[model samples]
Target: MSERRYMISGGGTGGHIYPAIAIAEELKGRHPEAEFLFVGAKDKMEMTKVPEAGFEIEGLWISGIQRKLSLSNLMFPFKLMSSMLKARTLLKRFKPNVVVGTGGYASGPLLKMASILKIPTLIQEQNAYAGITNKWLAEEAQSICVAYEGMEQFFPKEKVVFTGNPIRKDLLEVRSKREAGLKHFQLDSNKKTVLIVGGSLGSQRINELIAGQLSWFEAENLQVLWQCGKLYYDRYAALETESVKVLKFISNMDLAYAVADVIISRAGAGAVSELSLVGKPVLFIPSPNVAEDHQTKNAKSIEDKEAAVMLREKDLDDKFEPVFKNLIQDIELQKKLSKNILTLAKPLATKAIADEVERLENAVR
Candidate 1:
């Protein structure tokens, strides 16, 4: 047999990029002789992140159409055309056995072109609500890997696979790192720790909410481990005390998860999946600004399962304190939330998705 070649495209955010990388890594492990290539939007983070993961990547001049009228929206047609031509060229040159797309605008043109060329394409949708790119490419894709249920409403039910989002391998063992995490963070072992992460870049609204509640947290005898994001670290730096450790970013997420008794986070599909593995009670503050308010949908799905709590940005000012107070005081609720969320975790998601890819490859052969 000839060497197997795979082309994967997903970008724009860490949620999409990480899952793409995870799937690629899993496939690489299985087929050590396989060649992998990643395609992402030219100016997007994946251009840097994909290569950082030790995979060669090609960038397409593509981006999502903005909701509001703007210069970029006007240029959308030309960009799409150019991207389609470039995608066709890449496909012809690479002749990949399988093309995988994790949701991002960059994947749209590439996957569509792959389908046109009669290549098997697999798309991974990471949100409870389908993304525009994934939705558009649904019919053409051979398999639709999804993290949420009821996704059949958006895609052909026969093609949808209930494979959860892929998470970093290191996070799987976070449960065993409590003692080491405590020592690393220099926190009192007796105090309950609250971990706040507002995604990679951090959410301004979440940062503000945390800032306003600092004194309240101290009064409740909770130690705060705040990842304020690189952009907002300077503004929140002076507020940090011995009990409140404010960091721009966390390099050791396993330790962070291990030390956390309660977690506050955004509801990106990737984060939700990781939090489920951590098995900690989580309060999700979904950003309302995302496409189709998908973040809210992501949080609501978990909340609906009684696996986690969802607090919208609009309700934060009125509901955050009461909701948080109730959650913190009720140990039973915390345990219930933790146990329920873990039930939603698919620790072997990367492998399962890879299995689907292999199936596609075998079917074509």
Candidate 2:
């Protein structure tokens, strides 16, 4: 009978932020009168992104601990304490009925405080590998929504729910946008198009790999649509030509996915989930530098299912040409990959996660 209030926290990368936004959007659609608040690490992209998505967000003075000895690592305690206090203040002021965490620096403190206050909390783990923040908060969470199986190793088995990762609503229609995508990118329908996405900030290694293989792609008569990320656009912009389209970032991802015959991508959980829905043949190059080598684990999960192919960063130099050559030359393999990945897609993931949130809300009442 009364308006519902929800507080969501996730950040540090687009992978975490986007899923948090998707869940919030789903909840908003279900309860038009609901109030939502998002908390993210200060200076992180979520500060800008969440607002652009039409949600108010607050920032916490927190960041991940660096693996190496550094000034920031030393400051971790102080930052954590400050963030915890701030989170407590926010929770007290807002008095949300339910809190959701999507795994990020800010979520650690915010969700922990919410749990201590005895408010219902739910945590969403996008990666096959659990993030440190989510793992720490798992004990206090009422529900744990996960994108991959075997997450019981990270959280309580009874609390785990396999809902998959939440993706952009627009991406759901990529299959119907083939012609519009080709026209928007000005590509030839006759030529095979390879879409390369290296996450929001772009991957230096992926950019280098693409640049080195440009001549090979040209020789094979393949066209490329590359999202080089904002950080590396200038370096690769000069390499663009008639058959290659270079972009700093892709705002119209549905079109990009629609035009792609084969996709080369990073194996972040969010990307993997969206690619599954796009139903495109994807070659994943998981970043080795990530925490606990989780990106590799993320890619391996799909590869294990025979839904996609994964090329490790360390193996790229030696295996890329051979693996890519085989993939492109085999039409049947492409079709098989597309059909298999789509089977793993959970198009109702957002709604399912929201259903859990609603359950928590109802329990609180």
Candidate 3:
């Protein structure tokens, strides 16, 4: 029997990249002999992150269209044509049994080419609101896996699968790791620990909000485990004190989530999914700058269900103190948040996505 070959493409942000990695990791576990290839946009984080995750990746000369006219927009047509030609060459040479796209600039070209070639293709749409790339690919996609309900509004009903977003498998066992997490971060096991993550690159607004509220956190007797992100670490590292721990990034997120009694985070699709699985009380400050204002929508979906709280960037100055104070004091509210968020978790998402790929591959064969 010939070895199975798979191609996965998604990048630009951890939101897209991590899910693709999780699905690939799951597929690798199930089919150890499978040959894997990752296609990502050149100069995007995936070019580095994918290889670091132990996979061969090819970078395409592709980028997302800027909303406003720019020099990059002038080069769009040429880049698209070049990417498509390169994608054709890659597809013809590798002959993958299946192509999976998690949605990014690279995914648009690679998966579009795969569909044109009549290869089995699956797209994992992570956000509650679909991105332009995923929306464009929906018609040709064999399967459209999504994290939230009502995705049929964006894609064909028949092709949609409510598979949720793929998250780190280690997060699955957070319930038992609280002690280890506290020890790992060298924090008090007795004090309530609040973890703040603003994504890999960090959010400037979120960093500023946390900076202004250090005294409030101290007054509430909360210990802080802050991942200020690599982009703003130099600016925020000076704020670290005995009660607050600031880091460039939390390489061990499983431990960070484990130790967190409450979490303040940006409402990125990946963070929403991981926090759901972590089953902690979360206050989401959705980045206002995102396209389609999707982060607010992601936060709203959870907020609607009473699973978490959404604090808009504009409201931070007025609402942060009272909201944080009340949330910390209300043990019942914490219980409700934790229990409700856990109900939204799909821990087996990675396995389910890979299963969909296998099913599609078998049907085509």
Candidate 4:
């Protein structure tokens, strides 16, 4: 495959963007001379993140349609057409050997155009529940790489490959970093530590719940490492004390995982995958604002396997304390959860998905 030119599309959220970058990095490692281009929605997080990851990205004039009637929905047709035209232009110029979509608004148009042009395409569905964009591209996509089983309900069974979601390569070393993590976060090694994360932008409901429970946690002799997110940093910064370390973001997530005895987090696909590898007892509080209630579905999948416990956002007031107490206090339950969750870890997912991409590239050649 002549230098292996490639195109990858996925963004808007870290769940989508990180997997795209992981796949790109793996492919680049295998084929150092390969060329890569990323497609993302204009004015979205991908435009910034893709570039930072050392990949060139082109932005589409696109956004997801609002479920409720709004001004943005009216321009959907125009944005879709404009994005399609732009994608056609990019594909023609780039002449990629294989195009990959990780499920985002921009990916929908780019993959659709690539399919129509008879270009080989792959769609990576990170969630157990398929997103709208992936479902739309499934028929024409040459391969559908997914993190969960039973995705055949959304994509063609013949094309589906359960390769799993690619997570940060550093996360694999978490087990060896526990001491370093405790020092990094300045938390006590003897006390139980609970880490809370509410996705990239942060979940207001989660922050509120945690804030209300800070005294309760203190009484329980727990130390907290909280990533409240950028949006809520200002609001919750005052809560930081020796026992409660609050930050807007956790850059060294490997360390965060290492220091955590138990984790309370949103059940985004990326979070779920990373937590699985961390192998800690986790209490998933899935966000309700997401599309199709996917966070809940993701949490349920692990909960069904006894790998993690889940609490609905609406049930937080009544269920959070009791469930969390049981998880931390019960040593047997903690061990079981950690063991079961580790069983679901896919540390080599990046390479596996890259292998799939290369297989398609070779098939076409």
Q: Against the true structure, whose lDDT is highest? A: 2
Can you list the residue pairs that collide in candidate 2? none
Candidate 3 achieves a global lDDT of 0.92
**Tens-digit lDDT string for candidate 3 (1-365):** 34699999999888889999999999999889999999999999999999998999999999988889999999999999999999999999899999999988999989999999999999999998999999989999999999999999999999999999999788888878888888899999779999999988888998998898888788878899998888899998989888899998787899999888889999999999999998999999999898899999999999999999889988999998899788888999999999999999999999999999999999978
Off by over 4 Å in 4: none
TM-score computed on alpha carbons, candidate 1: 0.95
lDDT of 4 by residue, 1-365 (tens): 45689999998888888889988998888889999999999998889888988999999999999989998999999999999999999999999999999888999999999999999999999998898888888899999999999989898899999888998888887989999999999999999999999987688999999999999999999999999988899999999999999999887889999999999999999999999988999999999998889999999999999999999988999988889999989999999999999999998888889999999999988
Which tens-of-lDDT digit does each residue in 1-365 have in candidate 2? Answer: 24699999989888999999999999999889999999999998999999999999999999999889999999999999999999999999888999999988999999999999999999999998898888888888999999887889889999999999998899988878999999999999999999999998899999999999999999999999999998898999999888999999888999999999999999998999999999999999999999888999988888998899999888889999999999999999999999999999999999999999999999868
Position 163, candidate 1: lDDT: 90
Sort by TM-score, top down from the best: 2, 3, 4, 1
What lDDT does candidate 3 reach at residue 154? Answer: 95
Residue 112 error, candidate 3, Å: 0.6
In model 4, the Cα lDDT at residue 100 comes to 94
lDDT of each: 0.92, 0.93, 0.92, 0.92
Provide TM-scores for the models.
0.95, 0.97, 0.97, 0.97
Model 4 pairs in collision: none
Cα RMSD of predicted structure 4: 1.4
